[model samples]
Target chain A: MEVEGMPPARLREPAHRVSPRAVRYWTVNALLGNVLAWAVMFVIAWFLPEGRWWSTTLVWLFVVAMLANVVEVVVEPVVRYRRTRWEVRDGRVFVQTGWLSRDQRIAPLSRVQTVDTHRGAVMRLYRLANITVTTASAAGPITIPCLDTDLAEAVTAELARITGQTRGDAT
Target chain B: MLLLTPVRTLGSFAVPLVLAVLGVRRGRDEDPWWLLVVVAGAALAVVFGVVSWAVTRYRFTDEQVQLRSGVLSRRVTTAPLDRVRSVDIEAPPLHRVLGLAKVKVGTGVDATRLELDGVSAAQATDLRTYLLARSRVAGGDGEGAPAPVDAPGRGGTSYLGPAQPETELARIDWGWLRYAPFSLSSLVVVAGVFGVLAQFGDELPIDQIDVAQDAWRWVVAQALLALVGAVVLVVVVGWVVVSTVTYVLTWWNLRVVREGRGNLRITRGLLTTHSQTVERAKVRGALMGEPFLLRLVRGAELSAIATGVGTGGRTRVLPPAPRSVVVQVGHELLEEHGPLTMAMVGHGPRARRRIHVRHQWGTLLVTGALAVPTYLLQDLWVLGRLPDWGPPGLLVVLGLVNALVAESAWRNLGHGLTDRHLVVQTGTFMRTREVLERAGIIGWRIEQGFFQRRLGLADLMATTAAGSEVLTAPDIPLDLAVQLAGRATPGMLDDFLV
Candidate 1:
């Protein structure tokens, strides 16, 4: 990958991993989704006539779906939790996320349009919340998913204060 | 105002009117009960329009412009005068005939408009000038107020007067019409005509018509090759004529003028005239687009990347015209020559190879998928079976086409940085060179797929509030991407950069 007169492409990882409880939350979410899908598959299988060509195909598909779901529930959450990192410093927000395919975003505080927090029923049970920092760019709001509820609130307040102090409209 | 209501009502009921007329002709002896119903509807519409007009009260103070309307459920919309971004004056054919125009006051916020329908043309012009002048003064550029020119038809008014002199930036060249067919806008028009015809296909006596059979017979009489050539020639000529007419209708009397206080006023359209005033300060960049066909002819189109303009905030500044004209207009609009005309740094051999691999892989996957189905279904139907060489032959031709596209895409893959703008050019079919102001970039997003990361490449996107929202420099060296972001914003990315 080395090239003449070209510096290596590298980005410093952001500070602070998401709340550890996010792994548990994600696991439960994945399990629920898997269970619902499996239920639908079972219902379809039950109605299938015996010895049909597709009956065996559906069974193999069911097995593959189960294996994939197992990995999603057991492995992906932990990997995502370890990879996701975010920081609000130097009047800017930096977020780095994803396991295999990574993305790093940097948005200045002056460009922050709104800050909000969300706590779903499952998130509430895990005492976790998600904070969304929005800018005028249509790329969409930056979601710092699965933080400790209090930490999420504090971050939202801090972002709101910093954005409020800036003068010009976010655009 | 009284005439406007009935005309609008009648216009909306045109389909019903036609059906009623046909019904009357079909059954002349029957009572014309539908006419009475139509009269009643018109009367109700008139009453509603009159009452709404009478109830609507609009007033402007130093701070805000307030409009209060509605008889049953009162509503008030107030926009701060200082925030007024643009004022558009439009007069459709009916409105023009009635000497009335629609005034739309934009506040730069998305989709929030204060519309005054059916105002006297003179009053609409006055409001536009007054609002724009106030916005300019309030913006505090220190230029003070523009000199007020007397309104053409109206004599002394305290609040109504046209704003300062305008300098014409560009006018319709007529010669640009040659590039219209290449633009493919007429293809859409032609498709729309066919779509409408297809919608009424069932009603038309197509099955009973012998024209199609006669055409087939006529084609059979001629040499197959000659018939194909004639059809192609006819289609191409037809497209050229249709596109030219479409271009003329859309861009008739097109003018881009720089008005006092730096506002760019774009006035165009033939039957339904439209005049849009773009606040100069809101313009963030310029986008020059060269479609594949247009590029072959050395033609390009230009657009202003501004807030609260056209959809996605891109207002066309130049119709498809000579590349030289586009470049000149782009430079003028951006107030910078380097970014638009500078030689851009290509994304290196790795990016070029990546494009080839991607396009070739895609072509292979598509052809493979089709070949597999064709092979499997060979016994089921005669048409399902391809000849021994057909699959490979199709693949080779498609592969060659994709290779050409990949080469063009790779060549177009470049980015440049000027003192004030970050320029990124990419795309194969519609090659776009975006010159985005560094100041307009609000954020940066660096994305790397697994393979891209392995290859030390990343897609660097500068997120902005202007046209398209994000401009991407795809598959640039990761370090270069970072450097571009840091240099463009100067210290914004310092802490994050390794």
Candidate 2:
């Protein structure tokens, strides 16, 4: 099928890439949260009766979580950043990104209910913003995580324009 | 000012009042002040009702309907008349007895904007009719393009207007009563029976009688062969009586009529009267649903995929009827040639294989999960509770049943695209054949899971702003799925593909 040649590269690269600094911001924030949680678990483990089933379980959990957090915070963010892509044109918005399974969603601007951007403190520090486009579909919002603030604004403006152009008929 | 404010207020407190009275009667011997307590509660209720009545206010403007209420934290809401998609009125037995009804105004955006709890029945009807007429005018001008005012009496034109003469489209026929026992509505009746028993259970000496224990003894006393037959008989008899009663209550006096140019008005219910008006313009297509049991009687349910109804998928344009009746209604509603009653395009052998694998695996996965617990707790552990060989025998029976179901589902799976519309049919227990207009489709989604990809299968979904939102044709070949997506809305796949 002609579609065979249409996927993978263009699907992920046609849209503006999210800020590269997103990986560092996400990893640092995730590591901090994991350390804080581990501290609480350590305190609980100190009070637990020595050599009990729960104590051993907690010790194993702490070790496994520490490793998992390192991989999740350090590795996953970089992979996700590379995979994420979004574009808005004409009467449609396209997003292609997923952790394991490649989920490509094309939401018509006519179905879009809201378009908003968010910048958390960490993201703000990294000069990055996230744009979320919500359609009336029950599949939930289509989000473009960690883009340059100016690009996010441009995307939002373009979306608004498309939404206006495609308005009236569907409703 | 609403005339039924007092009645509406009383309706709010009726449930609590009944419970309070029941509690007082039950505690009469224990507490001498029980009657006094009930009287005091009633007095407080009256005071609250009066306060609420004084605060509540509602009015209609040229473009919007405004409502205000609440004693301390006042909330004022305005709903644009044009945005209003449906105006539904319902009256429970209590409201019917008092000649009052509840009015719910919905704008497809929000679930329900305004609900006037108590209004005189005649007032409810008048309000509904007025709102519907106004809504039709608003919707026609809503798109900023003047809707073409086609001449009425044209065979194919769907329009809404004040001058359009009212004509009865369909009404409830008791001849379809035979199909009631085969409907899922019977399950609702069974649930209602349980609900009634649970509500009055404490006063009924149910615990003292130990019905469960008695039933167990009876089952033990009966021969195994006799037990199966008796159980089947009881279940079938109970199902028939319950379903018949439920069907009557839900569909009693049901009627559908074309009142205005593009408005279809439906009035139904026995114990709880329901009146709903849906704009014909918003109707994208019709879906004919036939559950496993209903299939035996050749009865099908017809529901409209219309916008602004806020019903999601429960938008029934016609009740369960024979295949011919449902098809006729479908044709009349869409004003197109029998889209709902089409000869479907069947899938290839590969599609059948994919469906069989999909259905069989789903059933086996569930059965395997159940069997694992039975093996661990009963067989391996020798709990002696389950009869020997019972669990394994049940597993075998389930496997056979699942195979038949998978085969049935595979046989039913098909999709066809015509010049004006697309028809997709699938399902095992709940067979649904949806017919959607080609133009109503707004977008497309193509999905292929791990197993599906391996099987060279893809699920294609046609997304529309209205109706079910997404109509999917599952387990079709990847190439065909792509073709269907392209055909659903031309050039939609081109941008994404390149």
Fnat for each model:
0.64, 0.14
Q: What TM-score between 0 and 1 does chain B of candidate 1 receive?
A: 0.85
Write candidate 2's Cα lDDT for A1-171 as tens digits. 233443321222436667888888878788878888878877877887887766897788888987887888878888877767777766777776655444556767786778999999888999999888876545436778888999889879888777766644454
Per-candidate interface DockQ score: 0.55, 0.23
**Runs off by more than 4 Å, candidate 1:** A1-9, A45-53, B30-41, B55-57, B61-63, B67-78, B139-165, B193-234, B377-384, B388-390
- Which RMSD values do the candidates have, in order? 4.3, 6.6
- TM-scores for all candidates: the values are 0.89, 0.79
State, as a TM-score between 0 and 1, how close model 2 is to the true structure.
Answer: 0.79
Give me the overall lDDT of model 1.
Answer: 0.82
lDDT of candidates 1 onward, in order: 0.82, 0.73
Worst 10 residues of 2 chain B by lDDT: B150-159
